[model samples]
Target: MYVKFRKSSRVFLITVLFGMLMILSASAQTGAPINVRGSITDVAGEPLIGVNILLQGTSTGTVTDYDGNFELRVPADGVLEVSYIGYKPQTIPVNNRTSVLIVMQEDTEMLEELVVIGYGTVRKDDATGS
Candidate 1:
């Protein structure tokens, strides 16, 4: 008795092999997530809670817990931006930083708002002239 694979069977087998090869190649080129751990604190050296920590240009983010500790997994070699409501925003390179401690200073200068009145928008500083 002799057994042989039909043409369609051979084509299906080849297609499956090609798909698996592509999947494996793609996965091998992908990098793993880098672990990031940090603590947020105020200028006075006190731990600041509820501080917002975000990776710049991405939606990945986390908030400091009550102990002012935050841990997140970001793609390797990404940039991170840290900010809080009353504190100045800071941007840091995350290339080799696995653990970090950041002190955020309060922003004393308030941002003036611009409003649109009638036909055009006016800056808060120039609103009186318009």
Candidate 2:
């Protein structure tokens, strides 16, 4: 069997194959969704309640339970970003791990400042009454 493709036809065929290959490779890299379990704590080893656990580059996320434990289904290679109020956020790579532990550090600079609503910040000497 012999089949010949015209110049334009060949270009279109090649482009289609390239597009399929790209889609396949992207899906392969992302891999399958796996259950990941982890916990968040402070430097003192106390569970941090209501901590935010988000998948980097994606809107999928969850919050910690009262015990600071969280479970989420994410891509095998996805990265996890943990955050909490008054603490430094941490980014951890999944790397196919089934379990993870995160420790949040206090953001001292934030604790020392007074953030004014809508106004950003104002010095105590500036004087304000609302």
Cα lDDT of model 1 by residue, 13-106, tens digit: 9999999999999865554578999999998889999988898898989999998999988766677899876578999777757898999988
Q: List the global CA lDDT of all models.
A: 0.81, 0.88
lDDT of 2: 0.88
Candidate 1: where is the Cα deviation over 4 Å?
1-31, 111-130
TM-score of each predicted structure versus truth: 0.61, 0.71
User: How much does candidate 1 score in TM-score?
Assistant: 0.61
lDDT string for model 2 (1-130, tens) is 1244577788899999999999999999877899999989999999999999999998999999999999999989999998886798889999999899999999977655544557466654464678
| Candidate 2 wrong stretches, greater than 4 Å | 1-24, 114-130
RMSD of 1: 6.5
